[model samples]
Target: MKDGWIVNRAGLINFWYYDDEVFEFMDGRLLIRGANGSGKSVTMQSFIPLLLDGNKSPERLDPFGSRARKLEDYLLGEEALSQTNERTGYIYMEFKKQNTKNYLTIGMGLRARRGQPMDSWGFTLLDGRRVG
Candidate 1:
């Protein structure tokens, strides 16, 4: 069996946020603070549980447990906010082994283009393969 991994950090690129954002975990827990419409939920949900299992079903993407929202909404936004019809984004989690420099990295690469279905891929880097 492979070594156990503990989450160290997660982040987003070009999804919801125009700028890259990183969420660092303290003992596998995260506490975030921000005003309404600030994108806190989208930031966390993009990684947690999703990274753990690589399931991006609508049920898992929405924190409210509603099937109304879609991951595409985060990548390309609504008709008004989107600057381009096509775009690519990423969500990643960095994991570290207990008391060691070893790591395991997992993530998803997502692309959305108008008049087309979303294209995506999932990956894992193990045996001390860090995100660096």
Candidate 2:
């Protein structure tokens, strides 16, 4: 399969509690090492807001369950319902099969304001050709 960087993320929010953020991963394997509560899980949690319209707390039994609910509510507020911040960077993902040397790319971006409809952009490619 074609090998290349699949996902790119920048200006992440809850991921690390950092003011500004950038992260990229290829092939869907992420290697994170840091001190406890150093924001590793927080950084990962940032995506929950983006993926689920708003963030949903993980089941109470899950490690990050408490924060999940809090974050979800934060994202789904009445004025700013979008999970991702308008100023945050974008995320891109690509995939490849085990034996078939083929690749696909997916890209997405989000923009929202306190009183505006959230905006999104997405594109997909197969073998570097737009098929969907």
Candidate 3:
């Protein structure tokens, strides 16, 4: 039997260009290819450190490690796309046992209001449990 867990998928809901998107992986590998302004970076930045530890520091929101973006910017939308004063979103990654049906899932949920600081929560589920 294979000995360890492998990533099975990543999901985004109401985040960036995705109202709901699910990315499936093959043998723990996923290739995210898209055109410019197509949200490839946004998708990566939204997951990595955020899903890894639920940290929302501005620097973590950018792939360049610069504080050029904010979690609120994604939730409340940018000035031009600001259609709602408040919003919530979720990001998650799921892993499957190397040779079994068992699985583990981890995710972060973020909330933002136009004039309020952002808030977030992180969670983990085992035995294939999930939320989305």
How well does each candidate superpose onto the true structure, as a TM-score?
Answer: 0.84, 0.45, 0.89
| Cα lDDT of model 1 by residue, 71-122, tens digit | 7877888767767788898888988876667777888889998768899999
lDDT for 34 in candidate 2 is: 98
Q: Where in model 2 is the C-alpha error above 4 Å?
A: 1-28, 46-63, 66-88, 99-101, 115-117, 129-132
The candidate with the higher lDDT, 1 or 3, is 3
Q: Name the best candidate (by TM-score).
A: 3
Specify the poorest-scoring 10-residue window by lDDT in model 2: 8-17
Best-performing candidate as measured by lDDT: 3
Deviation (Å) of 97 in candidate 2: 2.7
| Model 2 residue 99 CA deviation in Å | 5.3
Cα-based lDDT for every prediction: 0.79, 0.46, 0.83
Q: Which stretches of model 1 miss by more than 4 angstroms?
A: 1-4
**lDDT winner, 2 or 3:** 3
lDDT of 2: 0.46
Candidate 1 global lDDT: 0.79
